[model samples]
Each structure stands twice: as structure tokens, then as C-alpha cells.
Target: MPEHSYLGLASAMHRLTELVIRAAMSELSFPSLSGRASCGLDAACGNGDHSIWLAQALLPEGQVTGLDICREGLLQARKASAKAGLADKLAYIQGDLHSLPFRDRAFDWAWCADCLWPGPKSQGFLGMDPMPVLEELVRVVRPGGLIAILFWSSQRLLPGHPYLEARLNATRAACYPFQEGGSFLDHILSAPVWLHQAGLEKIRGQTFVADLHTAVDGQAGDDLAACFQMLWGRAMPELSEADKAQFERLCHKSSPDFIANRPGYYGFITYTLFFGLVTSRPR
Candidate 1:
């Protein structure tokens, strides 16, 4: 885990690439998404992991431009894309998602992942109205181009501690980016409605699950630990002493009674993608 980082974004994503790739791309048909598109946009690309993969898998010959507002993230993205041999097919840009720095209808396709958790001033979420961002996404895509927005929908960890897990989820910290002051628009399940309201056609959604069982030692274990940390680290203060002890025993890799070390251990995380096609603007 990286110091001063809430989620240990880069390291976690790296260690979880196996599940990440499957969970993110499982429902996607790259051939159908690509077709005759010559250029693609990875909007708000955090580390460019998905960008590089999408470039190689979705557009074998087309260029994929990754856009983000964070300078450091873009720098890391540039490095990662280069390291993945996608330096030729990938480019990184520092830009805001709500105000994409591209001409109208500039991209043939667009992909944005884990970027639309909504709350007032929430760092993890995009922290504002997602409608503006959706509108911007629609504006820049060609009339017939595809636009996909992905959300890290849900996860069921702690196989036997459903009650404790539920308590953890009830905490405001655990639901940070999805706390109070949000409407139906903030909910991930309403994504198709968002796309339709933003003037996109053929809006649809699909969810992919990444399941793992009793993983210990290796990237999977590390990733599982990171997932536990990311989901419940901040919620510790809200938990009771017993709950805290249980969480520590289960989530801490150093604990003698870690959950993953037990037999029949199973956990799964889900990623949901909602996509729509840009439509011609009214004359």
C-alpha cells in the first residue's frame, strides 16, 4: 500500500489485474465496440491500465487517448502505457471530464471506469453532478459512437461475517462516496436512465463478477487484502470493539485467524458497465 493513499490505487490495481481484467471486460465485446472506429477516448483514465488493455484489445490499430484531471495520475498513466508497449497506440491528456478538451464528435468511442460515484465534495466520487459529465461525454462522441461508463458496483467479502459486513456497510465512511444528499441519479443502477437523459440512445447495462476462493500468498492475496482495506479501513471508527477485532482477524494477513486462510473461503466483487450510443443533435 502507498503512503498517504486512501485506496493504494496503483498497487492494488496492479496486483488485481487478473480479476480486474475479467471483471471489467467480461461483458464487453471488443469487436462490436470497435468495429470501424478509428479513435477512442478513455475518459478520466486514472492509471491507464484499462486504457492500455482497451487499446490492445478493442482497437488493434486505432489510437486511444486517456484523459484525466490529475497531473500525477496522468504521469503515472503515461509511464504505465509506455511500459505496456502501448506508447504508440496510447496518449495521455490532463483534462476534466465535465469539460473534455476535445472537439465535438472527435472520438468514435469512449470508455470511463469507476468515475461516477456521486456525493457533495466526495473525493472518491467525481464529487459533483454526473449529468454534466455525461453530457460532455455525449457531446464529444460521434453520433453513432459508443460510450460506456463503468462503476465498481458491489462486493460480498467476509463470507461468514455477513452481519458484521452489513454493519460496516451501514457506516457513513464505508459508504463515503454514496452518502447523504444524493438522488436516484447518484445510484449506479440508474445509469441507463442517466444515459437516456443525457441524450444517448440504446442505453444498456451489464455486470461482471470476479470470484476468488481461499487465495493466500501471491497477487490475488495481496489484492484481496487491499480490497478489504479499501472497503472498510475508514469505517473502523464506526465499528464496535468486537466488530473491529473480528475485522482485524479476518482482513489482516498477519493475523493467525485470517479468513482467507480458512477452508471454503469465497468472495466476489462486481463491476457494472452501462453503455449508450451518441445520437445526432437536433438541427
Candidate 2:
């Protein structure tokens, strides 16, 4: 992922899918989090997108701390939170996900987005064991508090090109968070089990979908283009010449047949969250 383009891409994605994100959050209940003193952590909160969401959700009282490994991202997050006038309720910090910077039971809850693990080693973040990272999340959250881990579970962007899309998805880049010899536990849906292993209780899962069925224009169109890149960015080596040509024809923003430009285009992606409660303090 290009550092220069992440903020814009992230911003566009947030704008495009905020409705579904909000809907997903609405279905979740954290009675304790609504209080004025409750403190929550937005783990790996990039550009403070979900951090702002958390802040708004805990409105009129609760405070949120946004933590990320990237300083640039935290800077952008600070700007964004301040712009939203949530600086009072939100704080930014630079820290590693593998070892959170806070103390034991520091927060009432933890909301982790697609940041629990790194992407392919060939990409920006060197892929590593996520168990330690998850343990850190559980460590900082208080007993009886909530811990939520979210993932970009699936995407259906290349309409009418299921085969190509399937192949693209099969590529190593698409199957993220996969270990070289990983088991089913490596899958995103296995998050509940992760929480269970980390000693969380009431393990459960839910998925939220962001669908683009209507007209997509201007920045949204470009953002959709960026989404295409992220989904199948590194599949060029795996795709045949013909497949590559077809991918460019349909996916590239400059192409006349770009999916976003076509009439009645439909694409949807899902964000799934697996949450559980800390039944007892970590020993």
C-alpha cells in the first residue's frame, strides 16, 4: 500500500461504507461503555476512521484512545479527530500491536479493526504470529469488558467475472493472514476461537456488509478503483496474459468498461467482528 495514498483511500472507504459500519455497531450492546468514565481503545486505528466511530458511539461522555504503529497514520488520525471536534474524547498514541503500550485492564473495551495481523511479508507489514497481538489486546482490557476484532472478510467487486475474481482471490495476497502451513484457525471466521483461546467469554460473531448498488461517481469511483487495487493488486504475476488484459479492461480506472462507471453496478464487501468479554483479569 502506498503511504501517500492510504489516507485518501481510507477516507473514501470510510465514506462509502460508514452506513453499514454504523449499522453493525448498532447491533452490538455495551451497556458499560455508554458511561462518562468508560475508556476504550481503538486498536490500530488508521487515520482514526473507526476511532471516530468509537468516539461518536460513546458520545457525550466516554473517551477513546486510538493506538497505531504508524506515526503518519496517527498524525492523520489526530487531524481527523480534531476536525470532527472529538479531540476531547479521543487520544492518539504510537505503539505496536504485538505489545500494546498500556497497562493491565487499562480500558473498559477494545475495538480492533483490520489491524490484528500484518499483510503478506512481501507487502508493507511483515506477517507474524497474531496470537501475541491478540493476547495484548485482551491484556489491556478489564475484566467483564468487551474485546472486538474485525476483519475485511470478503469482497465481490468484479461483477460478471466470478471466475477471474475467484482466481484473483485465490492468490496469496488475497488470502491474507494465511500462514505458510496454517490451519482453519488462521481463517477470519475463526476469530471467536481466538477469543476463546485468549480467555474471553461469550464469544460470538457478526458480519456487516457495505453494498454499492447505485451510481458511483467522482471520488467514490476513484475509491472503488483503489479498492480494486487492494483486492487484486499483486495478482498480476499469477494471472495469465489474457486474464491480465481482461482485469485491466474491467478494473483499471482509465478503462471505459470500469465497473464503477457502468450503469447499475453492484459490489459488496463484508466486515466481520468477533467479540467476547474478559470474564476475569489476566493473571
Candidate 3:
């Protein structure tokens, strides 16, 4: 089975993305959530950091609900929310993406990060597929509400991005079936067109790229270690010993080149984040 655990490096990467997202939001004039207006939804809010950010953005009146299928991730999100003292403004649910638990036209907007990927490693789960979940996120939000989905960009266009390259390498080696694991770029570069096919409209999208910097006063060591653990740990359970060993070696060796500024070295990697607005029309 594919690993479901969120790596610390992934979390750090996510936090960095959050920073860029907030900056982009400010640049885009995304209205701040007031205590009395503008509710929000975070689709597939793994570990709740993004959801909590939404909830915090709401302040006193703008409430938010986060939904995800992973009970463990949800639990972590809940804890984080509570710790941040935003529990009252935020709520969470474990639900199917094909059929969101919210009422029709419930939310003003929805945001999901890395949620629309293919189904979980386990069978018999909804939203293990990207297309339907995309449809559902668009469906639940009121017309004109915005949708933001973030994912790793393709390596070819952003070759300096080590994280994206590493992730793609590990995933490909793990034998992910889709041409791109149903990537964000695949959906975003094609924007409202893809959403149009999913029965969404007025789709406008913008892409932002941020470098995933690991070097922070020697924190790179732990960051790389956690990334390796997240990659190999999740894979080892299902892979053959030979494959597992090879993967281990790969994970172990990947950090050094990036760390020491050796020949053929690349700096912090880039991640692509995409945001769009859902329209009233089907296309």
C-alpha cells in the first residue's frame, strides 16, 4: 500500500506554500474573511493547517469547515486547530468527495491542496479518482465561489525544483499508473476546460511557483530525513525487499547532492499552486 503518512518535510513544504498562498491572496484581492461574513471550505484538508488558516482568516464571524477522508489526518488537523485556539470557528468531517457532506450551494468558496489525486492505495474508496472529486468540490461551492487546488508541477518545466523531481521519481518508481499521477499541472494548465468537463464554469486560473527551500540553519538534515522516511516508509510495507532496498538507497542518496552544493547541484525546488473561480454555467 502507498504511504499515507505526511512527512515532516512535506509539512514544511506545505507551510512554505501557505506563505506564498497568503501573499498571492493579498495580491489578488481575495477578500479577507470577516467575523460576520464570508464562510469558507477547505476540501481534503489533510492535517488541517490549511483549513485552520481558512478558519483563522474568518476571524470571529466567518466560519469554516474542512472535510477529508483520512481519519488520522483529520485528527491531527483537529488537534492543531485546537492548539491554535481556532476550534470554535473550524469544523471537520470525514466524508466522501463524490458526495460532499455539505448542503447544496453551501459554501462561498472551497480550497483543496493535493486532494484531487487518484484514490487512496486502498480499494473501495470514493475520491480515489481526481476527476470526480474535482466535480464534487466545484459542485458544493456556490456559483462564483473560487476553487484553489495545489499540486507538484512537472519536472520538465521546473527542472530546478528538487522536491517535485524527488516526488515524481519516487512515485514513478513505485509504479503510479497515471501519466502524471493526475497532477495539478495536468488539471490547471488546462483549467476551466477540465472543470468545464466536470460541469463547472467561469473558470479563471493563475499559477504560482515557489521554491521548497530546505536549508535553514542545518534544518535540512531533519527535513531530508523526514522526506526519506515518508517516501520509503510508506513504500517498504508493500514493496519487495530488493525494491525496498533500492528505494532506501535512492532516498538516502538524494539529499546529499542537493545539500552540499556539489557539482550538478540544484537549490530549493519549486511547487506549483493553482487557483480558479467556479462559474454558474456548465462550461
The Cα local distance difference test for each model comes to: 0.76, 0.79, 0.58
Error of 2 at 90 (Å): 0.5
- Residues 47-102 of candidate 3 have per-residue lDDT tens digits of 78877766655536777788887788788888998999988888999986778888
Instruction: lDDT for model 1, please.
Output: 0.76
Candidate 1 structure quality by residue, lDDT tens digits, 15-50: 554465645654565556546536889997777777
Off-target runs (Cα >4 Å) in candidate 3 are 1-3, 7-12, 24-29, 32-36, 58-60, 119-129, 154-171, 174-177, 180-192, 212-217, 228-266, 281-283
| Minimal lDDT window, size 10, model 2 | 117-126
Task: Note the residue pairs that clash in candidate 3.
Answer: 35-61, 118-128, 119-128, 161-269
Candidate 2 per-residue lDDT over residues 147-170, each given as its tens digit: 888877888988899999998888
Give model 3's clash tally: 4
The C-alpha RMSD of each candidate to the native structure, in angstroms, is: 2.8, 2.5, 5.7
lDDT at residue 149 of model 2 (Cα atoms): 84
